[model samples]
Target: MKRFFQSIISSNSVALRTRGLLLLSLLLITTTFNASATCVRKDFSDSGGDLYGTSLRLGNINLTSDDLQPVGTVLATSVVNLFPSVGLTNPDTVMFECDLADANNIYQAFATNGDSNVGGFTNFGDNYFQTFFRYTALKLTNVESGVEFTRIWQKVPITHYATVGNKIQIRGRDFSPIRAELIKTDKYDPTPATNSFGCPGPSAIGYTGNYTCPQPNGYVAFSGPGVELEELGHDANLDWTSWGLVRYYALGMNLGPVSTLTNNNTCGVVSTTPLVTFAKISPAELTAGGNRTGSFNVQIKCQDGVESGVQHGQTSIAIQTSMPAYVAAQKINLVNGSGGVSYLLSDGYGTDSSVATGVGIRLEDSKGVTRYFTGWAPCDSTCASSDNSGWYPVLSNADSVGESGGYTTYESTYTAILEAIPGQTPKAGKVDATAYVLVKVQ
Candidate 1:
C-alpha cells in the first residue's frame, strides 16, 4: 500500500518548466534533509541527497554602527516561524531560503572577507549594483502560502540567510484529503504577517505598517508578492494545480563560490606594528613656513584574541593605495577628499627614498582632521566617526578591540602640515614621510 499519490509521472520540460515526477518517497526525501547541514542546501534531484540544517544565530554579531539602518530597515529576524512539518508524505513542501554566500568584495566588511554562513550581501548604498545588503538573509512568508520574506536593521557579523526556503516539507505525491490534525495550537494562532511569516518590527505589533525606530537593532516589515533573492534554491516544483503559491527567481540555486580569497599567499598578523616618527625639518624651515609642522604618536597594543570568524569590535583606518611610486606621486586629494578643500602630503618611506621635493608630509588626526586618500566615507551612521570622509576611525570599547580576548590599545596623534600647494615650494633634502594605513575589521 504505502500509497502517497501511490506513484506518478508527467512532464514537458522548459517553458519556464513543467517537468514531472515531483518528490516524496526517496525514503521520505532522505529523512527530511539534515545530512550535516549548516545552510546552503541540496537534494531536489539529490546531488547525493540529505543535507539541510540551518542556524539563525543567537550570539556573535556585534559589529556596531548602532546597527545602521534606513533602507527598508528590519535587519535581523527569524527566531522562529518554520512551517510544513505535518504528518508528511508530501504536503506540498515549503519554507527555508538564503542568499549572499559571499557576494564578492567591493570593500566587503563585517566578519572579515564575509559569509562563512550568514555574514554578507551588499552592493552597498548604490553605484546601482542594485542596493542589496538587507538582513544578511531569511525573508519567507508561507503561513499556508501568502508568500513573503524581507529584511531590516542588522548590519553584522551575522549567520543564516534564507530566501528560496525549505526545511519543513511534505514534498510530492498527493491524492488530496485524508487529513485531520487540529489544534496545532490551542487557538488564536493567526500565523503572523498575523504568525507563520512575520518580521513586522515593534515585535509584530498587530499586522501592517506599525512603525518606530532609532535602531539599537530593531525593525521589520513585509508587504506581499515578494521574491528577489536571485539565487540559492528551494522552489522544488509541486505545481499542485498552479505552482502552490507561485515561486520564481529562476529556480534552484546557482552562483556559488563567491570568494574568500584563497591559495597560500596569506595575510593578517598583528602582535605589534609601529612606526611613526617625524620631527625635524629645514630647507629654510621648508620654504620659510610655506608649511612646516610635525607631530607623532601612534601606538597600538593588543596582547591576544582577534582571530576566529574575525569581527572584533571595530577598526577602519583606510588609505593605503599600495604606495611606493615615490610615495605615489605626492598623494593629494581635493581638500580632504571629495569634499575638497585642497590637501596633499607624505612622500618618502623606504623602497629607497628619492622623491622629497617641494615638501609633502600632510597627514592629520588629532583634531587637525584631514585624511582621505581613497574611497569609503558614506556607508551611513553619519560616516561612523569621520576623520575626513574616506575613513580613519579606530573604535571598539575598553578603548579598542573590545572582546576577542585580553588587553587592547589604540593611540594616535599625528599631524604635520601647513596646507597650500598650488605652485610648489617646501623643497629641501630629507623630510622623509611614508603613510599607509588600511587596517579594516568588524
Candidate 2:
C-alpha cells in the first residue's frame, strides 16, 4: 500500500507541475497583450486627451474622484486695542501669541486657520499678520524654545476698522471687543486768517505755518483717526467751509501695522474757501511815424496768482506799419578830363524815382575801356590862361574846359552808375542789393 501511494503522489506532482507551466504561459500571454494595449502609438489618443498623461497620473493616483475630500476649515477668534485713535490716525501695533509649530507649518496653518494660500509655503512661514488685519510675512522667534521661525500672519488692532465701526479680519481670523483710544494730535490751523499772508485772495495759496481753520466759519471738526482732511479738500474743491465730514490721512505712516498708530495725534483743519485767481494786461499806447509805423511790447501780469501777490506772464513784442509806398533816395554827379571822355549812368532810383541822383559815374573811351568817378560837378567849364592851361580843368565849371568842342557827344555816351549798392556777389549770378530801408521813430 505504501508503494502504490508513493507512485500516485509522484504522478500527481508531475501533473501539477505541468498545469502550473500552462498557467504561467497563459498569464504571460495575457500580460503582453495588456501592455501592448497600453503602449503609446502614433495614432493612439490618451484616455482623456492628455498627451503627456500628467493629468491621468494625478487623477488616477493622487486625486481620484472616488477619493475626493472637502477643503479644510479653520476658525480664529482674537481682539486687540489701539491708543490715541483720533486726529491723523496711525496704525495700531499689537502682539499675538501663536503656536510656533502651527505657524511654521504653512500648509496646516492656511488649511486650519482659514488664511490665504499664497505662493510658496516658505514665504508664509517668514511673514506674519498685523493689527491692520492684513497678512504679512514676519520673522518669528519661539521664545519657549529659543528657536526662530517665520510665518505669514495678520493682526487685529483696536483702532483697525474703527471708523466704520467694524472689526477687521486678520488673515481671515475674526476678532471682537477690540479697544481703541482716541489719540490727540498737535492742533494745526491752516486758516488764511491766521496765516501771515492773511486770508487767501481770489487765487491759490500755499500753506506756510501750522495752519488752522476756524471752527464755526467754513470748517468742520474731525472725529476719528485716519481721516484725511487734505484729501477731503481736494475732493471737495478745496472748499473747507462746508460742514460735512472729510477724509483725512497722514503722509508717511504705514497703514498696515498697528504700531504706526502712535502718530495719530497730529491733526489739522482747513478753511472752506475755494482758491480763486484774477489776471490782466496793461493797456498799450500807440505811436505814429512818418510812414504810419509803430510798435509796442505787451506786458502781462497776474493780480492774485503768486505768493508774493505778483505773478507775471510772458510779454509778446511785435511791429506793424501802414505805409507800403515809402522810399529813400541818394544823389551824385559826373565829371570829365579826370580820365576818359564817355560814360553811361543808371541811378539806383527805379521808376518810382520822383528825382534822379547819380551814385557813381563811369567814363569809357571809344575802345570800351572804363574808369569810375564819384561826387558832384558843376557844368562843363574852361580854364583861363592864368589857371595854367596845360592842366585839364575839372568839369565843375563849363568855362574851365581846356577845349570844349574837341570831343563829340552821343546819346549812348552817357555816364554809368550802379542802380543799387551790391551787397554780395554770387558765384554765377547777378549781385544782390538792399533796395529798401527801415526806420524807427518815437
TM-score of model number 1 = 0.22
Q: How displaced is residue 224 in candidate 2, in Å?
A: 85
Give the per-residue lDDT of model 2 (tens digit) for 158-228.
22221112222121111122211111111222222211122221111322211121111011112212221
lDDT of 1: 0.27
Off by over 4 Å in 2: 1-361, 377-442
**RMSD list, candidates in order:** 20.8, 44.7
TM-score between candidate 2 and the true structure: 0.11
Local accuracy of candidate 1 as per-residue lDDT tens digits, 331-356:
43333433212244444422335545
| Lowest summed lDDT window (length 10), candidate 2 | 55-64
- Give residue 218's lDDT in candidate 2 (0 to 100): 11
